[model samples]
Target: MTRSISLIPSGFPFLDKKWGGIYRGGSYLVIGPRKSGRTLLALQFASECAKSSEVCLYFTNMRPKDLMIQAASLNFDIQSYMNHNLLVVVRIASPSEIYDVPNPDDYLAEYLHDIVAVVNQYKPNRIVFDELTPYIGFRNIDYLNDVFLKTLEEVEDKNINSFFIIGEPATQKAQLIVDTLRHSVTGSILLKKKAEQLAGQFYGGTVIISPNVGHTEGQFTADYIIEPYKGISVEPTIMKTFTRNDSESEERLPELSKIFKPITKIKHENIDDMQMNFSNIYSIEDFHLIINNQIALFKSTGQEFHLVSLKLDSSAILKGLITLNQLKNSVGKSVQKKDKICIVENTILVLIAKTNAHLLNEIIKKIRINLPSRDEVYVKAVTEFIKIYTLEISNSFNNSAELIELILSEEATNAHLTLSELT
Candidate 1:
């Protein structure tokens, strides 16, 4: 007979929405490379589960001290859980100590047995195998598989949810082992470093629901970053577009209408005709054309142009657009006729002729000072919420598509996407 598994919130709206929370007695695989934020993701899951009064256990080969440090860095506060008796952390074996264990064959069996004993003693509601590969890597595949299967059976019998973190497999041998472990899990998520160049190292990957478990089976792509205090932040922009269906698409139309509704609802004489002038504004699509023209002009007359990106709150899109229009008016009054402005989605870009980063900053400062507080047009340089790119005509761009991707990637800035609270 099937039993109802208790569910725990995952703190991250994107994850909880996609995976339907961490279910008790469920096993999940989190696959990623070192520093790809997979560990942080697991810790976030474990912490949230513990917060809900579930007894959560963590088993890792990393030294307890080092694991604690890493957890602390990610704002996990694992120690607090220990204080409340909600968490039990087991340091299976340190990297250096694992190889030094005598009698490799017997050690594996006893080690697995010890972990099972601890689970029996505490009867945790959730469990995590942080870096499961190292524990079974040295043993014979057949022998280790048997032991692993036995361990899974014990956890399953207890109705305890589990998570296994596997390093990004590099070799055929490792891949084979990963496949073996994957077949046993209920669901899996993969995290990988994004190839796109940015100011800092950023990661993007996918979450796939196992066909054997969960309500969904398709793999959904997501972009995330590990923040100093905030931990993992998933981009809501991409997450909103991750899955599409007739029902979801139909629901989104009203939301879109709500944001743009003000454009027609609020009768402002100047704003009414703004839609007609959309053709005059250069779009992100026009990046290559504008850059090439600027380059030709620079080469002939020793002139320069720079691209400045301005973004507003994603959650406050309607308010932001109105603010953007106010900022646009401020910029229109200050900038020369030669300067070009564009609106792509919510962000605004200005192609300033005969300007450098320093001059652009000065102009931005004046715009901010001149902004009327009553208008609510808070416009600032692309330092955090957005990104700015300096374009040089001499710089080689293969095609317009490349330029578009670069500009759109500004959405992947370090700013975290906040979802409306899940009611």
Candidate 2:
């Protein structure tokens, strides 16, 4: 008979949406490089479980006092949980502190025994082993396996959910240790710095190496940012796009249409007969309608077009460095009559029809030349001050909203143009 496993919230919207929460009694491995926010993620999970009245045991090398303070800094109410007996913080000594003692193996064995004893006493519904690296390095593979297996068996017997946080392996022995533990766990998550540059900065991402509940085959990755009060927040747009299954494409249209429902429902009587005016700057709502029509036309005819965005620093405008009219005029003079301009917040969205990347760069250069700057010093800092992001819209995109969302997310940087680099 198949075993029935309960489910618990992951405390993250993106993760919960992707996997429908995690298995109640399952154990997972969360591996990441130093400062990649692995501990914070695990802490967030434990805190959320505690909030729901589930008992949680958090084991870490740091002092319990210090760990509680750190959790509070991230706005996690760890102290309240502790007061109510919903959360227990255990302090495990660092390997360096215990390795110097006589019969260090005996000390390690005693530590594992105490932890198991505590679990049997408290019967926590969730457990976390933070930074298992020190123990992995303290003993041989056999001893390490013995310690890990002992704890895993206890948790499994009690049907307790667990998370084992470890640093990315830097040596062969460490890799072997991690690999062995990985197979025994129900699933694994890898957090690391993004390899590619996004907006001139390397962002962090979380990859579901093996999910226990849903879509277990293919890997899913999502970008994330760490904040003081928020802990780790995943970018919802990228997560929604990347983690969506291909089979659900048919159901996604109506949901995507709702993103721009207000703009689409507007009645424009002579939209088709509208004269082309390159110098005219359109509002955000009108621009949305035009882009939607353009995208629909491309879907039916298979013709491609380019969407370029000139993102300006709002601080520059407030500081009297440049005026919106001056920037719009500069951009207007560079494009042909077929191109359309839309002002969205601090960005100027341009629709370039029947254009290629080479010609796009030429137009960008002309716009840069037309921009009014005080002197050569200001001209040299144009690239540093402003950003140019471009995306080529093709039949691959389902709707205009999706394309516009991708551009707004700043992920469509395949053909980004730097103003200073342009001759």
Candidate 3:
């Protein structure tokens, strides 16, 4: 007698039709570089699996709160599933934390034990270990192979579909570990960033490697875009040509300018106070004037600016000008001299001039790390009281007024803008 295989849909109908979803009792690898949408794809899969009434476990190296916020920004209702006990998110220590330990191996062993305990307790139908890089970095090749094989066996025995995510290895030893582990997985998905000449935009592409699935005779590849209020969706217009020698092919698609209105120049008077005060935080009204002027400048020139919004919840203990000043001091250290800060009610806005996604991410990380802790009474970090959102304003906008209106709408709705949405 032969055992029947079970299939779990990836939530996206297109992916299900193309790849036939993921196989239960199988282990898969998801590899990607920074800024790729690998994490979003995995979250979408987990959400879909949970919707089908299957228990799913997600073990992540990021803070659970931060991960929840990211999911919310992508319109993934993971909290509902968690409420019903269909989804469980477990937080694991980051690589820096693991490396700081006196005995890294001992710390990893304890965490492994904890993971096994959680898996046994939940008996989840699906599991995702988002990032095995830290674990692989600490152990030798033989040890890594042993542990990874054991993990595969456990998942197979439990009949759980698992996804092991990792970034592109940086070191030779790390690459070796990834290579050894790749041979043991049932399938692998690779995500890459494709840069386009039109407005220097970046798009994500996915390559699926498996014996069971393909769009044509060779490897399966697809272009994807991340949209606001929606997750990842396939871009059908862009065609990817694979050569016989597997060399890069150049092909031009329809320009984005054809889809959106052409960029127009705007004229505005230079505000005297724009360069007057760098240390002082402005009011929301001043923020409007300054940001509008900056946008006008961006329209005339090709310079870009990033608008960052930090909102505090009503339940937060920290409030008033004191907290705002503390936040400004903390954030001021990380930003450049050209950047400006504003505060209104519970929202704080920062206008950063001339920056890209990677640098912006680093700035945000620095701000989060430098955020001050509250007094003994509150005994909480400032990050606990606030949420951050970023929007990159480029030459794609029709006018400054329209862009400002969108920002106002997003602030009113408490909706956060992500890098993928604007880029």
Each prediction's total of clashing residue pairs, residues at least 3 apart in sequence or on different chains, is 1, 0, 0
Q: Candidate 1 clashing pairs? A: 25-161
lDDT by candidate, in order shown: 0.57, 0.66, 0.60
Q: In candidate 3, how many clashes are counted?
A: 0
Pairs with steric clashes in candidate 3 = none
Best by TM-score: 3
lDDT of 1 by residue, 1-423 (tens): 878766656555566776666566877887777666667777777777788888888876655544544565445657667878888876654333444667564555656666678888778988877766555554466776777778888988888878888776666556666666676777666666555632254344443333236535334556666554355677656553333222432110000001100000111011111212333366655766876677667667877566655554553322222245554565565566677777776666667777776777676655455442221112221122333344433445544445445655844433323111100
Model 2 per-residue lDDT tens digits across residues 50-134: 9889998887775543454346435665656677888887666554446456866555555555667778877899888776665
Over 1-423, each residue of candidate 3 has an lDDT whose tens digit, in order, gives 555776668665545665576666877887776556667767876877787899888887655544654465355566667878888877665444564668665555444445556788778988887765555554556765776777778777878888887777655655665677777887666666556422123345554443322223333466776543355666656635343246654221111111111111111111111122456466667777887888888888978888877666554322311245455666776677678887666666788888888888888766655444322112232345566777788777755456556655655436763222322
- Among these predictions, the greatest lDDT belongs to 2
Minimal lDDT window, size 10, model 3: 254-263
Ranking 2 against 3 by TM-score, winner: 3
Could you give me the TM-score of model 1 versus the true structure? 0.52
Angstrom error of the Cα, residue 382, model 1: value is 25
TM-score of 2: 0.52
